[model samples]
Target: MAMAIRYERPYSHSAHWARRLAWVGLVVFLAAALSHRFGPLTTPHFLVLAGSGAALSALAVVLSGIGFIRLWRVGARGGRAAFVALLLAALPLGVAGYAAYAYFTRPMIYDVTTDPFASPPWLKVPVAHQDFLARPPVTLQDREIQATAYPELTGRRYEGALDRVLEGVRKVADEQGIVFTGEAGLENVISDLEDLAVKPDGDTGGESAITVVPVPSARPLEEGFLPRIGGPSDVLLQGEWRSLVFGFRFDVSIRLREEEETALVDMRVASRYGPHDLGLGAAFAERYLKALDAQLLGIAGN
Candidate 1:
């Protein structure tokens, strides 16, 4: 007798929910991107939404993968739809993955400072971040990074009076929309280094105010003054970056020393945060210095 084979009908599946979930992921990702790119969505809000959307899309991809496998193994209906679901789900998942990687791997610094060791210390306030209390004043890594990245930002000597230099510094800062919070007069501007040093926490004896002081140089300038005094101005800058109203506070010190026929101007800008500044600090310094040049040279507006 010949053996007979029986053919069974394949299991039917519309896979409607799986396909819809994939489209939902894509839609959510696009919404998040649009909100972040041009939005009422704040940075924090966008971050939360983007992160959540990515995770949901990843889940959808997994589900779609399972659906695809089922359709293939049992010869079920909607195989094409299952494959489409998988492809669509992947788009958001990949974007979210990249973003997470960048956030964690990239440096934690967004602010920059020029003279970290000599920059004014922040007061013991709730708004102060961890950067204000950095140990060793300036870190070796920060020095190396700045030296390599911005070698041209060193202090320069200009011929002018101390008062003029101070005024120029203020004017340039104002033009750049940087707000000064505190002012140290000429006397305090040339104070001793030890007195102006940022002390350890809980000292309570040190002045909380930002001080202007002379950059202590080993060799005295015979043609000019021994040490040039710099006025320290605490500035808070507010701007928008990536759907967020970003604010960063730093110090700009303008040093002026009088000579027979000229004065030297040394300007330095340093921020409390480090590792990276997104070039904001460097750009600010460059712009202010250029404007000060125009002002000191009396060529501004001409």
Candidate 2:
């Protein structure tokens, strides 16, 4: 009698390593995202973790490809492991790919303003030390790029009083969940309103004495410059917004200028971190403006 022949199928070692790498990558990516969202990890730290996760995922994908080729050529087990590894790696790889695409295609600007020439001043300026990336200040070239890329992001003019427009702005901001961090120039509006209310009629001009009270001012005073007794020329409202998913903070400033009977509104938005906002600043500005337009419907002008 002839002896019976026996064979044992070999498993792809590449497939097993691919699966292990995919799981590790996925875990790292999740930890990074969640820590950034809810913990104390800074932007730089988060970026490092994310990059590491992406690199591991990419390696896993390469190993999975190799495993598939081997399985196709030579009969081998662990094909299921390779397939699962590929699936597991897809999430981080897809996100990294999308981010890369956006970085190349979109304007590499973290700040955007409706009026680039006279951008709204920040009431609470960003602290330089807090930024780990140390992005350079916005330049003239950046403004030009923004203008060309986002032509529709112009300031809004309304045929309404500054106070009325400001009320609408507050309402819209509240509706959109923007938290007011600081403000300036509102006292001037109040002073102007008081002056209008207490104006003397014609031929009733007389010397009037008014007592001034000193109070702590939020507005910064320039060296050798006297503090204004009257209100500022323009009202500035500074606020912050956070993304719902990632909780990424964004600084926002809205300037309201009273031009006779009209109110001109300009807005600026900037990401709290990163050199590239991926056009999110422009998108938020546009969304806020549209919401404001809807709130102030008939009074909106060019």
| Top candidate, metric lDDT | 2
Q: What would the per-residue lDDT of candidate 1 be over residues 184-251, giving only the tens digit for each residue?
A: 34552322234333456677775564333323222222454332223343222222122122344445
lDDT of 1 at 225: 34
Candidate 2 local lDDT, residue 293: 79
- Return the lDDT, model 2, position 68: 89
lDDT of 2 by residue, 67-160 (tens): 9888998877779989999999998898889879988988999999987665888877876344467688999799999999998888777655
- Per-candidate TM vs. native? 0.44, 0.81
lDDT of each: 0.52, 0.78
- In model 1, the Cα lDDT at residue 137 comes to 46
Instruction: Report the error of model 1 at residue 261, Å.
Output: 5.5
Residue 154 CA displacement from its true place in model 2, Å: 1.0
